[model samples]
Target: MKFTTVFVALVSAVPAVFGLTINTPANVVECQPILFSWSGGQSPYYLTLVPGGQSMASPIKSFPTQTGTSYTWNVDLQANTIFNIALKDSTGSTAYSDIVTIMSGSDTSCP
Candidate 1:
């Protein structure tokens, strides 16, 4: 039992030691460009945008490649739309960020 506990703890710590962070724009304006950023991972991280639980395999735009700790992409969002951002590292490990909701044009002052 003690050995199992130690193994679990070490495995869990691996991800934290590597350092990974994914973030999205605080204010996403409708019908405008929004940038998504992430950090602390390997190169060629996979980025995906899923809308309403549907796979957005083909994102409107993507970074294609990531270096260092972050990447940015511009996306056009519609009113009242919710999307999920997924990031997969080169080691086949995956992390998911928070959901992003887009407001309508009338609700936002974005051009």
Candidate 2:
């Protein structure tokens, strides 16, 4: 009886410990568009593409249909620039992905 109870308790705790995971492409071509993917979460979530600590001029994008675990965005990036992405749930819960580096142009500085 004790073993069965412990097993049930472990199974019940699994859902609470799981969270959404966001994954991006390993290598993205410079000055091109790329898609980001995620898994293990429900919908009513928002996706934002921001650089540094400032929000983009445009409004943050959202997914209306809570279907799959993946989302995609088309971003035009410049050379030697880094960007960050965030996934926010309806209840204000948020998760951040890793920094993505875009190297699309020459390294020379403008004179």
Candidate 3:
């Protein structure tokens, strides 16, 4: 009985144990389009972008959708800057992606 209970508990906790995982590049050029993807989480996710290395309280982007796992973000910010992505489910549970480095633009400087 003890073994069975333990096994069941672990099985039930799988989802919470293996929360969300975001997949994206560590470095990307500025003013380019990139796709951010995630797995192991629920649907109707919210994507928020926060500038890296800053103590900003608000996110740069608060895009919410229930369409797909990948989100296309246009990196039109500044070069050499870092950005972090946060994906949240309907329950307010969130998963964060690794910080990404933005390279210089191939054209004019970012506005």
**Which candidate has the top score in TM-score?**
3
Candidate 3, superposed: residue stretches over 4 Å from native: 16-18, 53-56, 109-111
**Angstrom error at residue 28, model 3:** 1.4
- Candidate 1 lDDT by residue in tens digits, 1-111: 999999999999987987666786677667566666777667668876666454445553344756555544434556677777777778766666677777665545433
Candidate 3 lDDT by residue in tens digits, 1-111: 999999999999998777887786655778777788887677888888877744244787677585578887777777877778877887767777677778887764543
Candidate 2 residues lying further than 4 Å off, grouped into runs, are 1-17, 52-67, 105-111
Candidate 2 per-residue lDDT, tens place, 1-111, comes to: 999999999999875676776675666545455677776556776777566444444423343444466655444555556656677666655666677676554332421
Give the deviation of candidate 2 from the true structure as CA RMSD: 5.6
Full-model lDDT, candidate 1: 0.66
- In model 3, residue pairs whose N, Cα or C atoms come closer than 3 Å (at least 3 residues apart or on different chains), thus clashing, are none
* Model 3: per-residue Cα lDDT at residue 14: 95
Each candidate's number of clashing pairs is: 2, 0, 0
**Ten residues in a row with the worst lDDT in model 3?**
52-61
| Candidate 3 local lDDT, residue 56 | 47
Worst 10-residue stretch by lDDT in candidate 1? 52-61
Q: Once model 3 is optimally superposed onto the true structure by TM-score, how far is the C-alpha of residue 23 displaced, in angstroms? A: 1.7
Error of 1 at 18 (Å): 1.6
